[model samples]
Target: MANNSDIKRRDFVKTAGAVGAAAAAAARIQGAPAIQKVKAANNQVQYGMIGTGGRGQYLLRHLNSIDGGRCLAVCDIYRPNLEAAIKTSKDKPKGYLDYRELLARTDIDAVLIAVPLYLHFPITRDALLAGKHVFCEKSLVFKPEEVHALRALASSRPKQVLQVGLQRRYSKFYQTAKQMIEKGMLGNVTHVYAQWHRNPGWRMRQSPDPKRQREWNWRLFREFSGGLTAELASHQIDVATWMFGAEPEFVVGVGSLDTMKDGRDVYDNIQLIFNYPGGRKLMYSAISTNKHLSLFQGTRTEFGEVIMGTEGTIEITVGTDDEPAIGLWFYEPGPPKVEKAAGVKEKPVIAGATLATTGRGQIGLPILFERDLVTGKESFLARELKYARLWLYKRGIMVPEEDRNPVDVELDEFFQCCRTGARPKADLQVGLADSTAVILSNLAMDEGRRVYFSEIEKMGRTPEAKGRKA
Candidate 1:
């Protein structure tokens, strides 16, 4: 037999589920664009891959399933990576030792760049100069001069599509979170806490040829890499900027090479605080010590973000292959209203002073997706399946999932933009802004001072200015 508590819990679940479904339905009614598929061979965007290393191969793996883009050529300085990229792509792309040789081919319409940080600008510039549309991975440029140069180059080629590899912009859950913020669901979002903590990060790899060791371990050196800021914090920093609807005004941070004393020049741990317009803040931390995450009841680890507001809070993170993306919402309870004492004319007396003194813990609610929402038009079986899934979700047995991975979505969108001349969500400007943050962040830590975003205008202007401290 069901007890009163069990009956009340079921009722609350039903009500909350209905509310979530209604929200989804409202979003649908507002005309959210459906995912598009490209099937025609002629309509496909013919593209080439440059720098077929780990990131390049990862993109190729996702690109294999994306019908909108077809890979024609792949290039890498290293022969093994080129071969691996060709094997990863279903299209059997032609492999090249020189990216220039691949770019010289007029048949290729666009190019995907996943080279190391130091090489990102030169290859992207060459590819653009070759009249190919470009999709470059994030921390788009290495130095401040590259930032100015790439912006100028991209602006000159107005017809060409230049997309950055920030996949979160393509995520549906992220989009929904933005909508919730706009709707004041998380009222007046003021602070965001983000972290990417890894245990024993970036092990050194031995190269067969001694000469290529530096090339293999480029990320460990400050000469080639911006280290943790460019590689890890860049993603979450973009998230904070996106959610805040403004760029950061200034940033101050501390970085240290405390662990992994194996000739690596970059910092192993970093903690930063960024101040945006309207006094909003984003606190970030990335460490090489542990992989524990406090969000989602410690069920996940490594990376996640917490957005806090006056009325509510949201804990969100992008998904991995083994786990789905999670967005947990918590509502802050309003303080109890003071009641006037019987027949008293003075200011309202506190109704139970003890009740108002204690903190009320909030229960987290799952942010529902489109599939979790039920329309009246669903078939009997479909509706029942949805209900069962909702029940499981409420019971913490299952979580909501995206219809497609954001990587595939971003790749498909890039191809679509190439074909249609549409602008990408993560365009050149977005990439530049992210890169600027990375550059300034490193400057702040190295110089031990607050670095202003406006300082980028003065940086890398003249040859001598590049070496000047902020």
Candidate 2:
């Protein structure tokens, strides 16, 4: 196993020699494309932001690097959060206590929503109705009705851009992986396994007041949050569906509040299986116990996905504050082909060997997606250097990474779309489908039965109707 120093050194060498002679060769061979620069109509897309909480502030930090959009206003129900937004904003955006007031602003061309899950629909609906292009965070809609309503509403506003916050869609690593899958690099993908675990998960916010406690700890309550499913599983589920090229047919799961007695109704551990057509499946788990991750040789912790196929498997995860995103592939080691007599019955190969026993001592190949630019175009030397780096990567001596973080790219693209009327990759349909998965996965755990994905078509149909009480 590689040590921390080994990991750091790998990242360092890759970073230090990211681009040189070999890069140019590969680009020349691969047709290196020029980067697209968004031309803003009036310098920048003037936008307002609502729900200036932790997520809202985190996005604002990334937005600082994006020049295509300018924040003109911010809104939050909490005074402190509104103040925090103003502090985070580079343009010194005006702050409002009520989101409605921010939506009424005429100067803003779009709105970025980072509010709580329950409030995502209402604020987004209002933002669209107010004639602003909207950028909403993931788990787009809380309820099934919100899914239908938002679909209809967003479709009606064709001129407006509605981008969701599934930033992995904007990642070059993920894009390259998808391309490989399409090109049959990973033949006949049959299963995807995903997990997001945390130690001492979801720390309850301290508040003396009852109302404030509920509001602060919304993620732990059924009415205001979707718990682990919406908060964590939603992202991975989207990844699984994207890789599989289909929505799940049904979901069945078990969840319980086995630990963490912190006045919360949400479960502390969950295990779910999503069945797709053609016998494909996605197995997902989220636990609030240990943070030990099962991928990347345990180099990373908390969250990741393993996509399995007949030819190979890819283990991938999105980046976080301190860790760069990574994707590693491993080829399957199947038995050698042999001719059999006609009508002869074949026994199962290695029937006693389970995943636990068979999934060891395999080498992982890092997926290289970044390109190098020497002066302007590709060079033969750069291409050579690229191959050299790949050799180091295969030996676990170095690892390659995306040149730019996807979060910033996704945010930048939102502003670019606002300027050029371009459609976002993570648009309305993708967001709603992801939300639908979250809704159903939670329902499966709650009802203790299999929940069909189609059931979402009927859920939340009645006005003011609620799902099962936690």
35 Cα displacement, candidate 2 (Å): 29
Measured with C-alpha atoms, the lDDT of residue 346 in candidate 1 is 87
For each candidate, C-alpha RMSD in Å?
A: 15.9, 14.3
List runs of model 1 lying over 4 Å from the truth.
1-40, 342-356, 374-389, 463-470
Model 2: how far is 324 from its true place, Å? 1.1
Query: Which 10 residues in a row give candidate 1 its minimum summed lDDT?
Result: 1-10
Which residue pairs come into collision in candidate 1? none
State the lDDT of candidate 1 residue by residue for 107-223, as single tens digits: 788899998888788777766666788999998999988898788777877888899999889888888888889989888999999999999889788976676576578898898
**Looking at model 2, how many pairs of residues clash?**
14
For each candidate in turn, the TM-score is: 0.85, 0.84
Q: How well is each residue in 217-248 modelled by candidate 2, as lDDT tens digits?
A: 88999988899999999988998888888999
Give the distance in Å from residue 271's predicted Cα in candidate 1 to where it truly belongs: 0.3
TM-score of 1: 0.85
